[model samples]
Target: MSAVPAGSPVRTGAVVPVLASAGITVALMQTLVIPVIPELPRLLNASAGATAWAITATLLAAAVATPIMGRLGDMYGKRRMLLISIGLLVAGSIVAALSSSLVPLIVGRALQGFAAGVIPLGISIMRDELPSDRLGTATAQMSASLGVGGALGLPAAALLAENISWHALFWVSAGLGVIILGLVLRFVPESSVRSGGRFDVLGGVGLSFGLISLLLAISQGADWGWTSAPTLGLFAVAVVTILAWGWWERRTSEPLVDLRTTARPQVLLTNLASMVFGFAMFAMSLVVPQLLQMPKATGFGLGQSMLASGLVMGPSGLVMLLTAPLSAKISAARGPKATLMLGAIVVAAGYGVGSILMGSVWEIVLVSLLIGAGIGLAYGAMPALIMSAVPVSETAAANSFNTLMRSIGTSVSSAVAGVILANLTINLGTHTLPSQTGFRTVLIIGAAAALVALAIAACIPTRSPTPTPPATPASAEAPATA
Candidate 1:
């Protein structure tokens, strides 16, 4: 529980690159399977609906794993948990690579999902190990890795799929996991920090079940008919479980999540805005690739290949990486609140571009870059905002919770956007595709989400810019005489 001695050496160079690489590796898993998704039914010898479970399984597993592993990292050692997460990624990739059927593939993908905890854990490590002055920049680049990995994954996977066996995709993932796991072991240090409390097994289980029920309902609601009994039942279960989880967390001394800390104005509002940001961020990813690949016969569709779609989205990821350092500087100079609000405005402007210019590849690329830069700025500042408000011991848990809020937002966006596009489809001879109006409506909603977040950020009570009291001046804590 004690801090490292003031002058103890901190290895800034090695830690930053290693943790950032680990983050990008884990994030790449989310998009790795995308390239092989359409052919899954044939590849795995399953019905279309059954094959879709590959995606759903990852979502459900990630939803459950992130919060639980985060608390584990706080209680035990961050590096230890980081290694475990990477191990799962490697094992999962191997399982998926060797599988010839749907069941193993889904199971493997879920295991990969368990590794989603890596990013938050990595962020926590940076907090514990980095110098105070270097903290902002390191965390910003670490956070931006989420977007970078996803953007890169698409094109890389698309290239493999086009040129090689679909199984090669999982093999690549496995190889990357192995290499990164080795680097993490070599470079990342175990923190002396520990909460030294009993694990809240009950709280963890309740939260897992609650998140599963909630995400299942959201992800499956469109396919099952939103009003179906199963969907409604899961939604009910989710609400009851979460409410009960909250009640239990309030009373448990060594709770998995400290509810009192999370309820503060700065933390609470930041989490709320993160949810809206997640919703807004996902709208573009959901819309853009589809817009690019849709048959040109639909007129508005660009009719690009899947590889081309991924290629176009690649620059967005680069911009996110390039913007992270600037975001960190802004947060350091002004405040994360100002940085977050700036991000929201930029994102709104990006959507504005999309609304007016949906015609060419170059135009779409520009819009995506703008939005990606906004996301980088916003993502980079979130951890700084959360860490400032909570005790140092709770950093991992707090960051984990914030990540969960974003996931929840993306889940909602998926369900809502899916329904909009599905219902507004136009039949073109042999196949159906989403209407131009559907795409426009989604963009409009995305812009609206960014603006809503901006307003929420504005409402967060800003701290008065208090000048520090003179160190030796008369005060209760200051000694009158030595």
Candidate 2:
């Protein structure tokens, strides 16, 4: 395919803010329900496990939708797919807001998961449309927006939930979705790049089932005993289906994911690093709020309210937001590998600090700041690595794969952390704390995961050399004549 003319106008600058808004809307939807998780049981007459679906269902939906949407974007158009995703978000939020039962709420949240593709689509658009000089900063800002939205949305959602009602949070999200849709429709220019390929319907279906089976097994394993028949059956299905899906992708002409490109050392290693980073990053999201809000009556707990707890974690997102540009600079000066290693080391240090200091809200806040900075640096570097490694054509699919890895990492970490915390209970006479010992144990594990990612990042070779063009006799003769 021919490239756009060098002098032709591209509205990349105008597109950035609209994509950023979309990023924030998606991030907010993911975490806005967190502050309400504790109250859901009473409000909806549901059990803790059932209420937890509000969060997991969104995750599961995103896990399935991201890759599918990425492939669809490749097959159709990124801007078109993006608008469709935003429309889904608006509709989902409205449905969730109006729901009177957990079932409808889960369905709505699932639909919102389709919007997770917005970030990657935005990144791909930047690569295709932005000028070379501005590309680095634009990518960094877009990547940082993920954490920014999450951090900014947490406190906002907390306050809204505290002042109004839980449903109000969804209503606010619906409003933001509409505004983002308007911005995108008006400002984001349509891509001239179009995929002439056909969609892999069968591959998409198989992959979806494979992912759902695996995620459901992992997420529900603790609730159902690990050795139970249902768990074992799901695990078996996941293994067989994923293997089959892999085989199918390899044979098909236009695979849902380009496995050959994805298997490149740089791409593979970057994705592995993403998994470890995702695991460590999400552990904080799970542990910090719970640690802060646990009653002080239980020796090791601070016992802050839900709103206050969300606020404590909220600043970490802000720190991440502030550091994204700095991270881009670091990557520019050194390389994405160096930046990733530095970020991982910082994350390891943050978790190590958390393991030692868990008594006060301020202490947790300080640790969060460190972790947030680490995430900013690491998250910003990932797309740079992926984009650099893959051809421009594969950008969206490659990114979605990386995103999927991160989500899987988070899901695994959530399950593992849940088990550890569940097993370790601190007795406070009348009540119990979340085994301070257990929390410490999990933090140590998180720190260790970061160190492992740091090692992987360190091992990746410096930039691969660009191929040299062969000299032609005509060119050589011209040079001699000159």
Candidate 3:
């Protein structure tokens, strides 16, 4: 593949589409079950709390698996790890398709989530393979794939669940995975750029435990009660574990994450912006659906069905698809930092306008579209910014860490939004639902988070000229290549 030379379009364009498709497949898993969540208990003969594990399992698995797989890709071949991730998705989907009980379903779901490393892996592959001129557009599209798959998947899953056996959902997911796997094998080239290392076994275990504890507490704290012992205990353990992990990473010869490079202001600030942007993007997703489906009798609600609400939000994904290339263009001319700041402002404006426009379905749809466009712009810039600062050998690990930050942001948004909607509700006779004020509060929070990202983006110094020297393999077992 390196035969295409540095600027060859054929070499650059050939890999991006398949890699992006793989990315979309990974993101689709996040929303595949949303339409069936309410019916899970009745369908599986389980309690609501027990059924909730299907979602939680995926979240936990993704948080732990993303960075680990990224590190593995750096040590191994990027294409090899990418294919492995896709294989896990297919296997998990097939297992879920065959399951009737909650245990098997949760197990399969977690397995599916284990494939969450694909997005970062794809981004890293692009960095290694694509020409610098093509890199921005290609990476941006890869980043937008996360939202595109999610937005498109919701309505598709809803339609499938409503029209056919719910098992069809998993089967279809499996089919998509298989198709993607084949496409990846046929078109995507294996990246030669390797950041080979002695995989830090203890550090990996510590980081995984730390992430699980922290994310679990954040995700479940609202359900378990914020002040509960289990929640507090998990939070405390997470802090200590994470601190220890950092200490170990700093000392280890072949660290899982390059703490020194990550400490640079550019990478640090870019990751910070990604987290806040993730938070801001999720706010629209959480609020718009609730606002649309709530009864119009509540005066603020649009009273749409779940399917209708999904349809209303589906167009946003298309907006993201269209905006990604434009974002890349802006980044090429003005720098990714400028693009990121622009995206932040646009997102903040989306929320500000959306708060006032909640009276109609079109208005809400417009808001989702606006937010999606901003997300596309910001998301596209992130990989470009990260790849610019990190070494070729550490590309996958750095990208994976950025993806993890986004996940952290989304998890916090879910917990925070859940709390606001829960407490700030209106009682209507025998029924209680989140008040319009609660929805407004969440939108405002989204705007504030975007503005915070904007400020952080401003702090990222304009793109630097410093270059990473080629690697002398990380260890005796590692490859000696870029």
Question: Which order, best to worst by TM-score?
Answer: 3, 1, 2
lDDT on C-alpha atoms for all candidate structures: 0.86, 0.81, 0.88
lDDT of 1 by residue, 1-482 (tens): 23233234556788898899889988888788787889988877888889888889999999888988888988887788888999999999999999999889999999999998888899888877777677888888888898899898899999999999888999999999988887776667677666667889999999999999999999999889889999999999999999999999999989999898788888899999999999999999899999999888899999999899999999998898889988888887788888889999999999988988899899999999999999999998888787776666677788889888988998899898999999889999988889999998898899999999899888765642121111211231221120
Per-prediction RMSD in angstroms?
4.9, 5.5, 3.5
- List candidate 2 segments past 4 Å from native: 1-8, 464-482
Q: Is candidate 2 or candidate 3 better by TM-score?
A: 3
Query: In candidate 3, which residue ranges exceed 4 Å CA deviation?
Result: 1-11, 464-482
Considering summed lDDT, which 10 consecutive residues are worst modelled in model 1?
Answer: 465-474
Leading candidate by lDDT: 3
TM-score of 1: 0.94
In the range 1-482, model 3's lDDT, one tens digit per residue, is 22222223334456888888899989999999988999999999999988999999999999999999999998988788888999999999999999999999999899999999999999987877665667778889999999998898888898999999779999999999998888777677676567565899998999999999999999889989999999999999999999999999999999988898889888999999999989999998899888989998998999998889899989998888889999988988888899999999999999999988999988998899899999999998898888777777878889999999999999999999999999999987899999999999999999999999999999998873222222233431332121
